[model samples]
Target: MVRSATTAEFRADLHAWLDVHEAELAPTYRGMGTLDEQIAQMQRVKAILYEADWMRYGWPERVGGLGGAAALRTELGASLAARDLMDPGHFSLVEVLAPTLIDFATPALAAEVVPSLLNGSEMWCQGFSEPETGSDLSSLRCRAVAEGDPSTATQWIINGQKVWTSLAHFSDRCVLLTRTGPPDSKHLGITAFFVDMDTPGITVRPIEMINGVREFAEVFFDDVVVSTDRILGSVNGGWAVAMSILPFERSSCFWQRIAYLYQRLQALTRLSEPTDRNAEIIGNAFLELHALRTRSRSTQHRLAAGATLGAETSIDKVLVAAGEHAVYNAARRLLHNTITLDDTVHGEQWRTEYLYSRSATIYGGTAEIQRNIIARRLLNLGDER
Candidate 1:
């Protein structure tokens, strides 16, 4: 499993491996169990893949990885999602936070922590959004001040709140952003930290989603003290850190999502009654899904080729939201009243997913925001304001 293998070979071998281990890897409950169960299933799958070295193939050798094309990791995730083994959105979070830590966190810190993350021994959350700042991250109010000599501060005290932090209550650590410069400095004032969740002054309150899943939380940091060693990059350089991770959040996370959308489309086609309208709707969904996949594949290739991802990735975010919406829309239309009225397992599954899809335009940055980034940065247009 550690040896060099093409993505194709990786996929084929993984499928065979999954075939042999399907009984153990499959979810114990039906129709997307409780958030706790989903988290457990994800961790269980990650631990197994890590033990087999499949999870480490695409990572750098310095961080307990086998060192190969990153696509190996994406392919592994896609295969898992296609088979309905896990929720692609949360599982793909590894692609978002892990690389940022590896790049910015001190070598000792990354070496000490990343393997546990990849192996599912720990969970981490991004702490950027605040009660007053959701997508307008530069306006965030969380503040962290060094507690000792400015040049060689040993500790920093953090105080403020973060909202809509996914998996916060369940996370073992947080990649936190804080205001470190003058209040008016905006993005340039921010600093990032790697804080332990059990640190004495932290509190978490879960927020249940419209679908009844308590997947996000509001976190309070009251006089939280963090070691200087936890600083994730240069002081007052967190905006860059935040920007660096967006590519992964917008692009890498969608690799598995694209697969999940395709899987849902397939399920919809099979479950719904066949008719001209059904065929047309399903076919249209497939078209959108294909567009998303094509764009995702290009983004993955760019990542593997060591390209610097930027505003171009906003397009991926746009496609992810649109593609997911199209698929679930078809599910709602084709399944007719089943999703709304039927109390069966499949009905609940479709209903929950359909509801979740409605948020596609909002999370991971909004569709309107993505369009603004596309227009301003990518197209050289003036700010919309």
Candidate 2:
């Protein structure tokens, strides 16, 4: 059995390991690459980390992890992001999806598949948002119906569309949400599934982002037959699964994103000349980033302590979006012509990142929606209007 270590011990050990293996883990292409290339690079890095046992820390033993506190995993991701070894967004998918699987899927199923995801042998995508149901997840229309008697059904037929599914084209499986109850049942009618991406009747069409990468995809499911054993959590209990995911998305995933933002801020400082305007911009951005990091750290500890996170995480979401915008906005202002018109590698990178940052508020629950959540759920204010 792998020995458990405190956060400090794990950090020191991981940093030393990274320092020694930097050459083997570093990406061949930096700052500029297609989405596929970036994904490949992330997988390579994950494979090496998994072999070194770093990726397994903080996860449960049942899921092939080393069974340390969840904070350990966040630190690993942060260290990687700080060193610019992996794209935090891509590296964070596991943090977003694996926990849901472990909590909701059957023990056997989780044990069988979570290891592949952890070890970099396969990639998975979350299938939640539909074309018409972005933030209003309760109104999703994806349909799943049992092909046999409800009590003994062995298969389910699913037909629906999911948009904005990150990394769908490269995924081996999907943690999908479908409406299994009456048409208007809303949240109560939903069910979650562990689906094979290669299953017949499933199609993935990549969508190119403003950043010039196909980071998102539209996934279509038509008459897709899935085994009953693939069900995650109780039938028609997908809302709970989705709720569980929100906290992780808003908190744990942001740890690495925060590290990435700090790296960008450092780069912006280095590229721009020392001027009052640049100084003010960087300083304001730094403050926002620091606030986000502090809030996110508290959330991580709450999660590690086994607290059930709910509307409280909306605050984290709002802060992270704000911090992301601030950092990239500063980059746009300081980099000036390079961000606007230059075609050099550094210029392209700044431009691409700036464009992508625009979606930070929109993804993982929009800033407006998060505010609504905070007002209605957290603050006991009136319903969202």
Candidate 3:
């Protein structure tokens, strides 16, 4: 077995490597472009990191990685985010989905597919939320029924719709959730599947965001037949698979986002003149970012220590949304007319980010929903419903 490098050692070695490879890894694009371009750029960066073995660290050996502490992966994301080589949100999708695959996917299946995602050879999307079921994921209506007798079925037929599926249009695969029981079954009846995008009867339609980027999409399944082997977990146990993904989404994924926010904050300071009001605004944003980072650091450590994270991670989600809004709000305010009028790269960037920040509270579980979870599950205050 390979001995894992400590966080400090990993940081030193990674920083040294980044310095040597900075020129090669630097993004060629200047400001926000189409989602396709951004994703392609992300793949380019991941390929380089994978070739150098930086992307393989912290993942299990069975999944085509050089086994090491998970913190190495977190640190790698931070490094990439700080340098603006990858979009933190898109870059972190792997962190959000891959672990669930490793935990629930068959050993053979995981080994066969996970390395593609890790090395950026393919992209996958999370098909969790439907048009009527964003926060109330248990109420998802997408249906997946076994084609033959349950005992001897070789394939499952899926039919339904999923909206707000991030990057679904560009994704090669999806970790989809579907109702397998009676409509009233809710959480208990849902099942998860790893479906290929090329599967017949699957349709992907892009949705343009206010930022002028097609960052999300609506996916429809009409008699899409999938091998039973694609089941992520036991039938009717998708809630567990989803539950495992949420903690990572709320915690591990936020590390890179926090790093990116800090980088944006620094840029905002550089753009603003040193005024009392500007100082106050920047200071408050910094504090929020700091709080988020502090909370997220704890969550990361817990995950690294192999703890099963639960509702407590709701706090991390809340802080991340708050910090994101604060940072971009500051940019909108401090940049003044430039943000509102100028058409330069910097101005457009600020405008785009400001608009995108509005959705921070909406994605990764809404702020209202997260607060409810904190109150009911973490604080034992009351029932969410």
Candidate 4:
């Protein structure tokens, strides 16, 4: 059974716990740590929080959770982001993928696998993106065919490729989507799976980003065999799972990221010595962050109230991209020559963040796609596609 707590009560309890455990939960990465180190730090935090039961709240008992309101989990993630205890990007993936597993996976499968993820014993990646199917994911061509006797246990043979699979090299498993029907089948014929990353015929090659970080990878599956139990949802009904994961990614993930961005914007303000001319720029950036926070809070409440978030979440995505770019642009503006030429730790940090900020528009659906969603779905302008 699920438990409920008033917002004030939950906040007071959570804050007291954080205060007592701050030292243990703090990120231990030294200056300029790689993505691997960041991920390791995230795992340490997750392990500690899970053991302490904070990580296990807001999840179902079937998945080894205490079964509280989902808002508690989102609040914990947002708190971690605010405190700089973890990378919100890596942390958001769990929010995005785990619920789908719980909702669609068999009870036994969810119970067995969800705890591994919640406690940080394993990492998982979403294998939705392909070389050709970035935003048009319904048209993905990664193939998986069932071959065997109809009565006996069936095994699926998978083939094709996935690109920009974040943290694939480090993931123990991948929630993969594949084409199960003809090319024109599109959304109808797609299927999803939870496959072990080490399965035979699977290969992962990390892709280096412009910031010289290999945070994503290209994954190739050639005749990979998976049991029927590995299927996430009904055969050829995987699009439902894929579609369901998006709201969590867009809203829950957005809340945590907004918290992180707000912290960074606060830090920028404190560290910056604003000129009269740049005051407007800084103010504009701060306003954007505030607007994003407000918008995201409403979305979070809607989620907590059990409302189904749909294409309208593209608004949050758009706000997030704008907020990120504005703050990073403010950093460049404030730091000026120091950001452009200095190689000091602070300067490099700023530089790396600035470069990474460029991708805010691209990841999780591009800005163009987001605007189209808002125009059509939210504003009812017209059908976009």
* lDDT on C-alpha atoms for all candidate structures: 0.89, 0.91, 0.90, 0.88
**Per-candidate TM vs. native?**
0.97, 0.97, 0.97, 0.95
Residue 87 displacement in candidate 2 (angstroms)? 0.4
**Model 1 alpha-carbon miss at residue 213, Å:** 0.7
lDDT, model 4: 0.88
Looking at model 1, which ten-residue stretch has the lowest summed lDDT? 1-10
Model 4 lDDT-worst window of ten: 1-10
lDDT per residue, candidate 4, 326-371, as tens digits?
9999989888776689887777777888888999999999999999
Q: Which stretches of candidate 3 lie over 4 Å from their true place?
A: 1-4
State how far residue 318 of model 3 sits from its true place (Å): 0.9
Q: For model 1, which pairs clash?
A: none
TM-score of 3: 0.97
Best candidate, lDDT? 2
Candidate 1 lDDT over residue span 1-385, tens digit each: 4364688887778888899999999999998887899999999999998998888988999999998887888888888998999999889878889989999999989999999999999999999898889778999889999997746999999999999999998899999999998988999899999999999999999999998789899999999999999999999999989988876776667988888889889988998778898999999999998999899889978877888888888899899898999999998888869888988888888888999999999988889999999999999889666
Model 2 per-residue lDDT tens digits across residues 84-181: 99899999999999999999999999999999998888999999999999989999999999987856899999999999999999999999999999
Error of 4 at 287 (Å): 0.9
**Superposition TM-score, candidate 4 onto the true structure:** 0.95
lDDT of 3 by residue, 178-294 (tens): 999899899999999999999999999999998888889999999999999999988999999998887678776799899999999998999889999999999999999999999
User: With candidate 2 superimposed using the best TM-score fit, by how many Å does residue 325's alpha carbon deviate from the native?
Assistant: 0.7
After the best TM-score superposition of candidate 1, give how far the Cα of residue 284 lies from its true spot, in angstroms.
0.8
